[model samples]
Target: MEIIVAKSAGFCFGVDNAVKKVYQLLDTNNERIFTFGPVIHNDQVVNYLKRKGVKIVNDIDEVNEKGHIVIRAHGVTPVIYKKIKDKGLILEDATCPYVKKIHNLVEQKSSEGYRIIIVGDKNHPEVIGINGWCNDNAYIVNSADDVEKLKKSDEKICVVAQTTITKEKWHEVNEALKEKFENILKFDTICSATTKRQSEVEEISKVVDLMIIMGDKKSSNTQKLCDISRKHCPLTFKVETSLDLPQIDVEKIKKIGISAGASTPDWVIEEVIRKMSELNNQEVTKNEVNQEDFNFADALEESFVRIRPGEIIKGKVIGFNANEVYVDLGYKADGIIPLEEYTDIPDFQIEKEVKVGDEIEVFVQQINDGEGNVRLSKKQVDINKAWEDVEKAYNDKTPLKAVVVEVVNGGVVASYRGVRIFVPGSQLSDRYVKDLKDFLKRTIEVRLIDFNQKRRKLVGSARVILEERKEKASKEIWETIEVGKTYNGVVKSLTDFGAFVDIGGVDGLIHVSELSWSRVNHPSEVLKVGDTVEVHVLEFDKDKKKISLGYRKEEDNPWVKVGQMYKEGVIVTVKVLRMTPFGAFVEVIEGVDGLVHISQISNKRITKVEDVLEVGMKVDAKIIEMDLENKKINLSIKEVKPIDPPDNNAKETGENKEEPEITEHKEEMEVTLADVIKTSEEVKS
Candidate 1:
């Protein structure tokens, strides 16, 4: 049988590091070694450590002797760390870095008033540990159905996944949460190594006659691999070691595929491969297999080939410190990426960005850095790909997001995926940018307007993107604009005559006369730049690209309630506004005025109305004639009766005094043709 082994099989970076830590503790120290739990899920590896005098305890209190305690890769909660410290035990933290990142994320988000949701099996140790970080308040869900049971809430939600869960499970739960919650943050925290292993099994199982999954049954990642394989290949068998291999019909199986979980050790995989090869060889000789079958039998014995220098390959991040990050390239020597080689960005924090079990593409710099390590450069790979992406964006006329990193002499420099592009001051915005420093560290969208790959020069214009969006918005506004329709707009600028408001992309003017029912001398009296106001489309000319907007509301018009508020013969206190040649104008209410003629100024004849009613005087007047259509009211002060006051001497004597009764009467005057014509002209005025 032809045996095809999956490339991403066997122990991942985290599991390997954890197991190695246990051995190192055993070899160097005489103190009793205790693990918080089984260091790994593989039974063979755990048993081997137990035989070597390593003790396993579920809790810190279970440790009877003072010794070194190693926290397993599946990290424990803060309570465990406190217990270890209180017991005075030497703590060796073997928690996977990627899992630790989730702990920090949950703790921060929970403190910030976000409800934490973990997408994984709640019973799993990793999920339980993560819950502890959030004060054991996280909602653990494994599928879409579990999300349905949660109560809908407006609280901001933060969703994180267990490091070993399948990508499909994470995606399914996230999609369900999106439908239920309006504000949610989803972090796909599934380990890259787990994803790679699951994907490889799916691909291999499709064409193979028999698929063999190797790992402990208790391992979550292992069970997931078996589940994925069974869907494509029914002849899938899961085994822990070579001794547990199931009986297979070697003659019938022409091709067999092999894949292992992250917890499975390399020795176990090699042993299984050796046993399968022996079985295939025996069947071939007995059946007198053809030359092609013999060649397939020999293929099982071949080992992994060595990688050459300067080759680009995928590696899993195993561990990292301040100086460098270590990667496993499926080779003997681990790859080392120095800080400078990892990224060009100066403020890059390795601990926050690089995590264990993450897959990264690296360019091999050297086979040996004189320290028996493979030197790798991740920045080199990124730089090479960034140029290609930049060229594509330039050719396709696609916009890219970039952050302004520096302000130079004539322009600003923006960094796009570590590639610097110069944006001239003129291209920074459609309007003049007085200070380029304002764009510093701010993210802006830009399209490449010019570039030269050979010269390593590029130019981008944020103005181009702004203009394009403005043009599209202008078109949409003109298509749907209707006269007298109201819109919410923001005041863009102010002038003496009007205020210009941006309803969408188009700017419409609100004349000072239309700003309010009350007179407005300047647009600034009613609106300032950036003030939001509701305006109606009074008139518009599409060809001129001009619009006239009205800001005064019909409901706010003072004349709307005049008919209900006033009528003829009603008494009112009026304020004299100004004196006209024919009459004195008084304000009845805001924006409404009444005219009092000289003839009706008082009971006695008056030559001038201003003589009795000067400007700014408050006087009681009776409304005689009202014309609602013309918005005019005629008031007569002489028609209103005055109240007489009692003498103070009568009160001092305690004598009852009679009060004088007041009566309203009109004064008759001689009439003339010129007088009648002049009165008529005064009423009209």
Candidate 2:
């Protein structure tokens, strides 16, 4: 029997590191050693540690002795860490680096005002640890439906995954988050080693007659390996040791495969391999059928083509269904690409994208021995090509075309082929973009601003594209632009100080002071995005590409009518707009104002302008002076015409001349002006 061992079978890097930390701790100190949980999932390893006097405590309170405490590979929450510290226990943190990284990410994102969402089992220790980093405020979800059940929030969301989760599941949950939220941040925290091991087991299981999966039954990753293998090979067995292997027909099984989970030790796997070899040898001697069977096996081997895992090959599309696509690999083995192995296209339509006789590159995932078929992945091939293209673009300073799939926190997601590129909100446009959702489903050209293959991160900038185009357009505009020339433009954005208008391809700033004929506090009061307006070029510099625009018409200045309409000593009702220590400025109309000096504020001595005037208070004033060239006006509140005195001759004649209109006007003016001054004095005292 040919025994094929998976390359990734054995303890992964994280598990190996954790196991080594325990042994290293044992060698250093004679004091009692304790772990917060089982050092690993395997019972044999835990028992072996127990023999070394290592105690496993679920809670820190269980430990009475002051000694060394080692955290398990699956880390504990922040509260546990603080408790350990409070007890003054010697801490030998054995948390897997990958899991620790996820903790840090969630903490940092949460502290940055982002609502944290952890996509993993809520009960899992790793997820619990991650949630603790964010004060347990994180939304823990295991499936896409959980995302839908979440309460809608406009708060920026940051999503992270458990290190052991499958990439497919991670993508599914994040995709759902995209649909439910307009501003989401996603981090693919699934460990690369976990993915490779699962993929290797899936590949090896298809090509073997019988598959043996080794790890403890309680190990979650081990159970996942068994599930993946059983789907491809019917003769699949999960065992923790050599003793657990079931009786097998060694003569019937010509090929066997072996794979182990991340927690399984190397010695256990070696023992299982030794036992299988011994069983096969004993069967050969007892049956005495090896010579005849060898000839049959040789003939069978010659009829089928041999393919290794991760081999890049060419294939022709033959047939397909909803779940899988059939391909002819030009060998005896027929190839098929499963739905998970296809490129990640949005709302992917297999029937339309794939057709018969279409040649495509595929990465060989598995080669079946019994059925003489292979498992292939077009997605893997495409991923490799995309990485190469991304690297090239980064080096060449070239722009790439992509579709904006979703708007996320701090960015938008633009995809090319199957690769997702992050474009920050600040990078989405040359001007500030308030609504990122406006770019969704639109094709955008972007330049790579940051690329890290090791971290599997790519950042693009659409602002770079916008800036490049604006630079060219600005150059052309400066060549012909002149002062006093009016250009029809659209409002691109607004700010407290100004409005940026897009004239052709260039942007010009219309200062808030020039937005209208009246006083304006913000640009939004008179202008908004996409509003078409005519603006005159006030100033421009070709070298700086700075264009200042004026939207207020020259003929619309209200000060021009000050001298013609109102002269000195003219009584008018004015509203107080603002006050200074020396005087008060009152608006005569919507766009016109006059200053009332402290000395002229009242018939009584005015110690302060506010003593007689309150903002928005209306009072009658006489225009004392007007300088139209300087656009300044002076007014006197005390100089208003007085009410006529009651007729004394009528009173002497007993003519009943009360003069109610004249007396009432005098009383009203005195009371109105006196109440304001009295109120101000009352507030001060």
Candidate 3:
């Protein structure tokens, strides 16, 4: 007998991904592993997992320990996700991407004020999950009769299908809804694998004497496959395992066909094919038997591509279109990469960027039997290489430079050799940077600070490189810096007491007291930020790297020439600088000041210095006492008053110019009295 097996059978992408996720968790995680539900409807796989220590948890509350909770391939409601997250449980979502798309589509449509209508079994987990996205406002209908029950309404409506629903059922439900609503948005959310499997069943069942459908009894897709086969061929049997195979009359059956559901495993289907082959006769005519095509197990195995998830494989570009590129992976089925999974390059032209016969490396995203293509990702391969390069740089502590491409929240994104890296706002500068966007479009050197290959993360810091450079320069500066050496410095900052200057590599303090020979109240009065000034190191602590700088040139001090410029009894013009309680301080030179005692001003008795002297007033004074050691000069303004000269008219009148002589004698008497007053004032202490 000739045996024909459907190509699109056994473990569709979604179920396979879910099962593999559990196996992966079992291999890596030490914590007790649990699946949110029976990972699949298959009893064999579930029992196998039970033997392997994987517990099946029906409800989230059944889990009392801290571990991971994997959402099954059928997906879960938003409330279940919330409960898992609220309980602080690690969640591994293995929801088929197609189901995720349906959830998103329904959510978007409902948010736009359309009444969502789901055409599928309401109790199905996939339908329930999609309904949850729309806040359960979706009208679930399984048949055209269910749509006939829907009340007539003017509200706009959107409809989507269950991933396992047949194309004919979707069209029938849509036609029923169209009769009731004028504005209806319909989306075929059915998984492509389901469509291909149903179609294969129909094609293989025609002209076959008997048909075998494989999968669990509870599997909706498997039941659909069986129904499709039964319509084309009357003698059909649905079996969950080899033991469930019906009693067959080997002599009567000339041609047999096989098909399975999306959830059926390959091994289960292989066992059924083996059982059927054992029941068949080995010898038959070529026209009646077609012996070359009777090996159903090997044919199914060959058709089921030998590929593992996440495997990197090499392939040649075979074809391209606007949304996908096709590659020949040297397997039964060609590989296809969607435009979204190809590259991150902006406005990428796949036609120009890739050509037929060009060999390319791809990451196997999923074994998608739905589309009859192996879903591959070029971007994932590039991202993997990018992460490796970033990890190497982080481990080696090497510098990496990249051009900032985009600015995002909390940081700016940069790309190095096609890998994106994040530089946090704080790490953008050695000092605080308020606007991270300022670095955009600029090339910056950064040190890789952190990396995670699993999460596909790369963190970089420009501040680390800047800090290292500063530290190195500081060490060099400390080793060379010495007291009594002059260096050019830039004013880095200023305070009330000092100006900080950067001399080559390190900052030193130029105290306000050392800014100039004259008194200064604030450093800003004589120095400002970024001003270059010559400074000499006065003191330094190498261990602390603290250097004290002197900005005023010693020879520039006006007091240095005090001995030559002024002496005791020397007369000079002085300005009253300030009034004190006991005396008036006067400036005799730019940097030199003398104190005029209250009693020395006008030779008058004064209660306060302000009573006899006004500030900023110029007057003549005699330097009475010079304390060179202490840089103090005492002056007497009253003693500097000119004595009256003899009158010329009195000399002409010969008026005994004795009056003029008497005047001169009176001046001498006044001088003598001033000395006596000074002596008395000095002795008052």
Candidate with maximal lDDT: 1
In model 3, how large is the Cα lDDT of residue 49?
Answer: 64
| Higher-ranked by TM-score: 2 or 3 | 3
Which residue runs of candidate 3 sit more than 4 Å off their true CA positions? 281-685
Q: List per-prediction Cα lDDT, in the order shown.
A: 0.83, 0.80, 0.81
Q: List the residue pairs that clash in candidate 3.
A: 193-370
Q: Give all TM-scores, in the order shown.
A: 0.44, 0.41, 0.42
- Give the alpha carbon lDDT tens digit for every residue of 102-130 in model 2: 88888899899999988888977778888
What value does the lDDT take at residue 485 in candidate 2? 90
What TM value does model 2 have? 0.41
Tens-digit per-residue lDDT, 129-214, candidate 1: 99999999999999999999998888899999999888888888898998788999888999998898899889989989999999
Q: Report the error of model 3 at residue 675, Å.
A: 99
In angstroms, how far off is 449's CA in candidate 3? 86
How well does model 2 score by local distance difference test?
0.80
Every model: Cα RMSD to truth? 21.6, 24.1, 23.2
Candidate 2, position 241, lDDT: 73
